[model samples]
Target: MPNPIKVVLVEDSAVAREIMQRLLDSSPEVDVVGTAQDGIQGLDVIAQTKPDVICVDLQMPRMDGLEFTQKVMSDYPRPILVVSNAVHPSDVDNIFNLMSAGALDFFPKPTSGTATDYEKLKSALVTKIKVLASKAK
Candidate 1:
């Protein structure tokens, strides 16, 4: 066995943040080192945790994920995985811009559906985290 993959989550929605935290914590291979409700707080948490990967949401107050990603790329340079509920064209375009800004991957926000849907999203996130962590290290 090895050290669990360290992760920091940056999301604005309290319910979404809590759900993600719980799901990630359920995996023994991952460790939720820290969490923040916005990008400003996220920067502090990421600095403190020094996580291998960051799960971030695009729409946040104070500092959205795009700006955060830019700052992180310029100053910190780390693997960032975007999880957003972007439905509009402009929003989706911003998500792509986030990738250009330095995010490693992007995924649509998981909807509150059936258990199977939830499980599938969880698995996808976990898999992406593992891959990103490995590549980051």
Candidate 2:
């Protein structure tokens, strides 16, 4: 088998972070190499892990996802996937801004707690990660 896709997760919410971690853990194609609760720490984690892809939340403390994406694009330049709650209009702007800043793709975080929703999210997440990793290769 090939090496799993290494990923660094940056999200401020502990519950959201845990949820993403669990979802990624269940995917055999992805690997959670590191996780950070804020963008400041996320930078350090990214540098240390040198992951193949990054999963980030937009609204975070210390530094937001847009800032993080700009910094990473300028420095690391890896595949960044925004896994955020894009509920508000401002969040839509943030998502677009993050893309312009060099995020490859994004998935709006699921609002519902249904298992089917979670499964779809998981499938999309894994598929995106694989595609991004393939492009990187």
Candidate 3:
């Protein structure tokens, strides 16, 4: 990417937010312009930053990714990527719901442990963001 893709992250866990930010920031192709703890704050950040793609958690305080995705699509119309570990349902209802709510993609929240884990997280996250960024354009 000639210019880094502007991104907004909406996650309730401070640790998860920080980890994801670091992962995204590791790639020169991605620029995490802003982050919010929850969807209400996410709305404000989204409005201010006008990111090219948004990364959101499915389960959050104040508002969940489903509602957040709905609002963002109607109000701002950006590509949304729901990165969450919320796929416990046998049928993967969370994934379907978020997709219907207008998320462009979904990924399991990356787990950090080994060097390979970090490398995999970096590649998958940046690749997803790159793909979603194109959808927004």
Q: Which numbered prediction scores highest in lDDT against the true structure?
A: 3
Candidate 3: deviation at residue 35, Å?
0.3
lDDT of 2 by residue, 1-137 (tens): 88899999999988888888888999888999999998999999999999999999888889999899999999898999888876244666776787789998887765447898789888888999899888787
What are the lDDT figures for the candidates, one per model?
0.87, 0.87, 0.90
What shift in Å separates residue 53 of candidate 2 from its native position after superposition? Answer: 0.4
| Candidate number of the best TM-score | 3
Candidate 2: pairs in clash = none
State the local distance difference test value for candidate 1: 0.87
In terms of TM-score, how similar is model 3 to the real structure? Answer: 0.95
- Candidate 3 C-alpha RMSD relative to the actual structure: 1.4
Instruction: Decide which is better by lDDT, 1 or 3.
Output: 3
lDDT of 1 by residue, 23-60 (tens): 78989999999999999999999888899999999899
Considering lDDT, which of the candidate structures 2 and 3 is the better prediction for this target? 3
1 or 2: which has the higher TM-score? 1
Question: What's the lDDT for residue 136 in model 3?
Answer: 74
